[model samples]
Target chain A: MNEVMSLLKNHRSIRKYSDRPVGREQVEEIVAAAQMASSSSNVQAYSVIAVTEQAGKDKLAELCGNQGYISECPVFLVWCADLSRLKAAAERHLPAGAETYESSVENFIVATVDAALAAQNGAVAAESMGLGIVYIGGIRNRSQEVAELLSLPQLVYPVFGMCVGYPDQEPGLRPRLPLEAVLHWEGYDAERSESGVKAYDETMVKYLRERTGGMKDTPWSVLMAEKLAQPARLHMREFLQRRGFGLK
Target chain B: MNEVMSLLKNHRSIRKYSDRPVGREQVEEIVAAAQMASSSSNVQAYSVIAVTEQAGKDKLAELCGNQGYISECPVFLVWCADLSRLKAAAERHLPAGAETYESSVENFIVATVDAALAAQNGAVAAESMGLGIVYIGGIRNRSQEVAELLSLPQLVYPVFGMCVGYPDQEPGLRPRLPLEAVLHWEGYDAERSESGVKAYDETMVKYLRERTGGMKDTPWSVLMAEKLAQPARLHMREFLQRRGFGLK
Candidate 1:
């Protein structure tokens, strides 16, 4: 593999950070790269808020499930799925008496996908600079508080948060489901996927035993099963609606 | 900028492809890179279908609103937001009578975000090796037929398609919204975003006029307003629910 491929395949989320500061210029460059990701019809319905201050980071860290790295990391970027700009654009330029702009599930998907794509680009750029990062989905645990803290307007919601800094700890790459499990040819193959999962369960059981010194050895299926049975962020639908998204 | 940042900033959708072929080895490498992208709680709730057969490509092209590049490209990849694997995992190990797994809008967002993050990584990997790519959101235009064609199981929905090959045309990089439009400090600044959009309107007007030889000289806001006012893929909500998603 080439350098880029090597870098990509070596990815491991870093939850610990060093004190080396990330300069503003680097953040700008990262955002520049992020702005270049593909958007649905150039809507580019996404925005990022970088929190570097102690109070802001502390509040964010507390809100995001008390993840200390969120405060320790030089940057905590809140990536948002934003359509407020599109609404502004529509209000400004839509022909008089034209159909009104309203957020639909389609727009919701478009904005969310756009946010993820751009954020991924930003993640890759950070890694390329020898900086490590981890995504904080706990950003959604209290979506209302996060929004209020960030002063987000209607049609704009924080999709996720990311912590970026030099690595203070080394972590092993978490294995993924085999390629056959996720990559299908022409069409999906159920049997192949089942077989892949069976094989991956064994791999995970062994990997966990080694990683956790046999303290947390369990098949991958067991963990996923537990996760699936529990409801996560149940307020997401209501919150999204409250934020003026997916109301169609 | 470094190599990766340079590449990311230089991205442009390639809608034309040369006659060169993409090998399975390259596809595996790309997928390997993709698998390394971050997933929320390591759910990795996404899958990919590679369509190389002429018939499959032709059908997908037709289904994707007749984007000729999808059929013409040497490799077309359909990326899916999948929860079926988690369902299967739940069935396999969930303490028998535990609450059954059901897809929710939260899962919907997680899966969609997972697919996009992986796809962006794959896009970057492909670009690193001297290939070009364009995302085809038109994949959602007729979700039912496309899903049937791919034999997607419940809880698996095509998020987007990507066409990859050697570039036959060198399209200029499409300028994005100014960084100031999307990047904020600590919190969102609507005033800055508005100003940025106003400045970008002038830039886009010149770009559109130049690109279209003095024709189609509308500002960015006008185009976005029209897009927002129109109903796009209105069936997405129904289609997703049918696919066993967003039903919580």
Candidate 2:
């Protein structure tokens, strides 16, 4: 692997942070790099909010399922799929009779993809600078509350959050599905996935056992089974609808 | 900025590619780097189909709005939001009478986000190896046909496709929104976006005039206005539903 690939493969989500602060200049640099990520048709329908104040982070930490690292990190960034800016621009530029489809499901997907692409770039940029980062999906646990806390406008939803700071603790790299399991050639290969995942289940079994001191030796499939049987963020659909996003 | 940030910032969508072929080993390296990207709780709900055969590429190219570059590129990758693997795993591990939420809207978002994050990493890794990439959102233009062509299984849908090869043309970097326009401090700043976009409108006007030799001097916002007025891939919701993704 090359140096850039090494940086990418070395990624680990940091949940513990040192007291070192992330300078605003550093944040700006990271954001600038993120802004350059591919946007669908250059709509750039995303916005990031850097929460540095103690109270703001504290509230966000609570909102994000009380992930205290959000509070401990020097910066907690809320990555939002924002269509309001596009809506505003469309209103400004379109002829008076033009109806806008800014909130269509397709645009929603575009905005979400744009936000994720930008966030990943920012994550890589921060890692290159010795900064550690963790994505907080719990930002969506109470999406409505998070929106209220950040005073987000209609048609803008927080997709995820990232906690950035110097690493105080190192975490092991999580094993992913085998390359064959995820990468197919020419067309879909359903046969490959079954065996690859069966093998991966064994690998993950050993990993979980070692990581948890043999207390949690359940196979990865079982863990995944438990996860799948449980509903997560069921409010998401309703919340997006209320935010003026078109799903139908 | 460091080398990695420089690479990230230097990104421009490559629409044209030379005849140089991308080796299988190179694609593996890129996939390996992409596999290391963060997944939602390590669910890793995504897959990639690497289409290298000319016939396969031609079919996909037609499916993706006849983008000639899809056929010309050495490799056309279909990145998929996949829940089928997780569902299979759940079925294997769960006891009888257990229901899975694998097709929920939440899982749909997670899968889509996972696919996008991985694709971005793959793009960067490829770029590091002196390759170029262009994301094809048109993969969803005729998503059902695309899915049929790839023989995609239930709960597996192509989020986007990417063309990868050596650049045959030098496209100037498209200017992005001002950093302040996308970055807010502590909360969403609606006021800042207005002025920032106004300034960026002027910037984009000049860029479009120069890029098209004064043939298309339209402002970025106006282009966005037209985009918003046109419904794109309205079949996405239904297609995803047919593929067993639950939006409700």
Candidate 3:
């Protein structure tokens, strides 16, 4: 396999990082790579904040569910789905005009997609440079504090954060649902796909057992059931609303 | 710059593709690269259906807003946010008295992110292999038809489609919002970013003028205003609801 393909296939989330600093030049290159990603209608409705200052990183780490690695990583980047820039632009260009555009849920979708695309590019670029990184979606767990810490404006929300550094440890590639289970041919063949799921459950069970040092392995299905059988995620909508998304 | 980085930096959305066939090996490698992307809780809740059959591609192309490139490309991939596999696994593995976890908007977000991350990896891998690709978000414009065409079940919605093949011609890297506009340092500073927008709008005006044979030479701000002033995007929520993603 080629180097890029190898990097992609061998990618594993790195939660542990070596105590080394990432230079500004590398950070600039990664952000530039992110800027190069495709944007919807070239809206580019996103922004990234590079957090290398110790105090700032510490505050962000606390805000993001106390994920210690966020502070320890050589580079911590917070990706924002920012409609604020456009809002400001509109205000300037159409002064006294009633902000005609709707900041609806669809707009959030576009921003989220744009941010995610750029972050993916950043991750790929970092990997190519022999750096390890992990995404911290828990940043959304307490969106309000994140917004406060980052001084995010209305219509600007942090989608996620990423930590980049040299790896202190190597984690195995987690097994995924079988390709057959996920890949539907002409139409979605649910029944046919389900057959593959049973086998995946078995594969995951075995994989977990090996990884977890003989602990009783949990099936992927039960874990998903546990995840959804609660109301933990209900706070997300309210959180978004409080963050000024007005997700109408 | 390395070949992969060069390819990434120079990437343009290839709306037109050649009829050259992408081999099965390349498709598998690309899918593997995609599968390597980070997933929420390691639950890879996404799947790709590679459509090589011309008739299937034609139907999908028609369903996806008559995008001619979908059929023209040697490989058309429909990326789906899938929850059915987990649903089935839960039904079979959970205790007899246990309740099934009803799919929710959170699940949809997880699935969508998973799908997008994978598709991007595939895109990067394809670019490294000297292939070109473009994302067709219009797949959502006719979600029901796409679902029917792809045989998708209740919880498996088509998020996007991708067209992949060797490029018939190279398009230049489209101009982007200036770094100041898209990169927030410590907080969201609209005033500070405005200058970047001013610069970028000038750059885009020049780019459009040069690329489109002096057709109007509209600035980025103007194009954005025209785009947001319309309510065409409101249909997305209704479409998602119809696809069984109860956004509550």
Cα RMSD for candidates in order: 1.1, 1.0, 2.2
DockQ order of candidates, best first?
2, 1, 3
Q: Could you estimate the TM-score for every candidate?
A: 0.98, 0.98, 0.94
Interface RMSD of each: 1.2, 0.9, 2.3
Pairs that collide in candidate 2 are none
Query: lDDT score of model 2?
Result: 0.91
Candidate 3 error regions (>4 Å): A94-101, B94-104
lDDT of 2 by residue, A187-216 (tens): 899999878888898999999889999998
- The sequence of per-residue lDDT tens digits that candidate 3 reaches over residues A171-210 is 9988877767766655667766777777877998999899
Interface RMSD of 1: 1.2
lDDT of 3: 0.78
Query: What range of 10 consecutive residues in model 3 chain B has the weakest lDDT sum?
Result: B98-107
DockQ of each: 0.82, 0.87, 0.55
Better of 2 and 3 by DockQ: 2
Ranking by TM-score, best first? 2, 1, 3
Q: Give the true-structure RMSD of model 1.
A: 1.1
Model 1, B128-218: lDDT tens per residue? Answer: 9999999999999999999999999999999999999999999887889999999999899999999999989999999988999998788
Best by DockQ: 2
Candidate 2's C-alpha runs over 4 A off are: none
